[model samples]
Target: MLTQEQISAYNEDGYVKIEGLFTPDEVEELGSEMIKIIGDWGEETIGWRGPWREKYLAEDEQQATKAVLMHNPHFYSATWGHVMFNEKLVGCVQDLIGSSVQWHHTVLHAKPPERGTPFPMHQDYPFYPHDGLDFVDCLLHLDDTPLESGSLCVVPGSHKDGGLEHIMGPDTAPHLPTDVYHPDKVESIPIPAKAGDVIFFSYCTIHWSNVNRTDKWRRSVRFGYHDSAMRPVGRYEDKVESIPIPAKAGDVIFFSYCTIHWSNVNRTDKWRRSVRFGYHDSAMRPVGRYEDDPYRIDPNNVLEGNTNTIVSGYKTNSEAN
Candidate 1:
């Protein structure tokens, strides 16, 4: 459990480094388990293929893709599960959480020496959004992390700033705007930790790391947890699969509002338009009353009669057709 002073630090700083949270033997065991598990399931090329590399790195000709990562190790090995639920670790989590907690997920973010990648300044909240702010992640260090070795750093107390907009794109992971939150401009605190140390921080905390210049592996496993009552708000990319419809000009496409759907962006000169109409069962009560929906037709866009009718062109069609 955290001491009063440590608790105060966490409360004020939105994070606190718990030195030697695990023993040396435990850290060594984690390292071994990771190696073995990685041998079983191949690691992924997790290096950012973006401008952050060019902006941060020292222009080394021989910098092989910077990092390797494995996700949800506990699903494959019992050792990870054991360590994830260890009494001491859970106790400290409970200390800050102040109630029953639920295990969210875990990931192993290990950076190899020389070209270990640097993460751009951003909050983890975008990656895993929740309704409440009690969600916290513990970065359990498995190897010594110094400033030169891409140690974790943060804009301390930034969690109190609440969630900020991230520069989300298809090419890159969610990060803060390059011009606004660049590492050179943002004031941050470097958190160099030993093998057994763990840094527990709120998900809203703005954090980033630099390229590992030292010739040693900077290995760490992150375990996230939240209050049992907390609810998650998932991003569309995280849960949805996009499949486009092969609709012709006159074809009408329809689907339930609950269905997850998306459309391809228009790139041609043709003005692709949609006239939508909605209906619901009268017996089924609405969760809330809504007004001023986009269902209305635009008067300016219409040529003459700004009719809301679906078949405005089909005026008085006879039975003979």
Candidate 2:
């Protein structure tokens, strides 16, 4: 569970980091499972996007294309399932989300050293906006990350502005206007973290990162979570903020979904690998397929032993009010 001080930091700055929440063994095991699944990705698993394989395929490349973030590892891998439903991980989220959580979605983001592409500044709300700012994303660090390794950068308190206007950039991703979000006004800050550390932030937070200039790979996993009553308010025109909540290997950080943040490209020669997962409040939200599906316990339940916190929550749709 998060301390009052840590929760205050999140409420005040839009993000907070909790140190050493996971054990070193658990972290190492997750890394191993990720490697096994990554080794098996091919035409059958990668879907279309054949050019991604032809144009950028390296002997040691992480994915077929940078655009393809691997989804639902837990569905195929038991190892991921354990990490996904880890009690400590879910309990912390329960405290912030204010109800029992539901499994949302997970994505794996890996950046190979030296050639990892740069992710531009953007907001996730444009694609997956929900009622108020109940959505949150956590970055689970799988390797040591430093500013030189293209760590995350974020704009503090930017989520309070609500959803800011954005436009599609050359890459077809929705992004803020560079002129208006200038460094002078937005104050981009780099957040460095270690393996097992996690950084949670809001969906509306405006943020971005720089290219990694180190010789090692900077990798981490991300999990998106939401309250039980939250639902999608919009779709990706495409989609994706902030704070430097740093931690050592085995720690997890939680933040509001609207916090503005981003990261740089890995310039190092090491591989940066990370897996992503998510939890949601299922009573009023969908369980992957449909919106009205009844919430199920056990198997994927994160609130297994922590039932006192469960409660019947808010809207199942935007028009409910």
Candidate 3:
């Protein structure tokens, strides 16, 4: 589905653009179906509405925030659902993250000519906070997006910084402070894309867009897919530092269940055995069961109706829903 080189690029740079991910026919279908699903709305009904509007625009250019947008297009059109379920796209994503990924949400961002909105630097973590860094957003372009036509710009390798602080309060959209991280202020790169191309980017990467100065509409459909087995840091705070503790046999490690942690894949064909169990205080009561619960899945036993001499700790997150 994806080359190892492509996967490596995403791991190192936080983003990768795949050209011709969809065919020309597929792109046309998406654009036409989107029109049908939205129908027609008066100009007054459309515009970007975020508190950062004033900080990024002038009195005259305030209307530039008049970008067109909608959420969950798949809810309205089966065509979108079909595209979301594209086999190559999903398999490529699995190659990067893991075997299991879930749909977080979908969005339609249609930038109108001249008055299209500009998204300031921001990390998507604030919009949909999750437990792991395996969360990825896929953008399907239906128009040729040049730098001036709100092409996405990203800070390379920034996801390694993990989540960053954003201005979040009542009635405000979460975004980085303009004074510190606007396009002109931050180190960035514009990702110009052709119709039918798809851009896969991490949720933690700092991203923003320019206004659509072109005459045509810059349309894109975005689907957010996340690994069910996500592992990341902070309840709501940005990452500070990471420490790796290498161990040998006979080593014991202890950590809070709340900590977002994962073990490297077992590379050997032979069994890599370990005994894992959790202990809690007598006063504590269990309310939720996670994916790796011992009670739900006995590590020592083979799957139901199967015979196995050794227990292989391979996991799969393969679900259409």
TM-score against native, each model? 0.71, 0.63, 0.69
Worst 10 residues of 3 by lDDT: 312-321
Alpha-carbon deviation at 275 in model 1, angstroms: 48
Clashing pairs in 1: none
Best by TM-score: 1
lDDT of 2 at 120: 52
lDDT values, one for every candidate: 0.81, 0.63, 0.78
Model 1, position 307: C-alpha lDDT score:
29
Encode model 1's per-residue lDDT on 2-50: one tens digit a residue: 8999988888898999999899898888889988877788565747656
Instruction: Write model 3 residue lDDT over 117-153, tens digit each, in one string.
Output: 8888899988887777889999889999988898999
User: Per-residue lDDT for 162-188 in model 2, tens only?
Assistant: 787876544345667655664445687
Off by over 4 Å in 3: 40-47, 231-321
| Window of ten residues with lowest summed lDDT in model 2 | 42-51
Ranking by lDDT: 1, 3, 2
Flag regions of model 2 displaced more than 4 Å.
42-68, 169-171, 182-185, 235-321
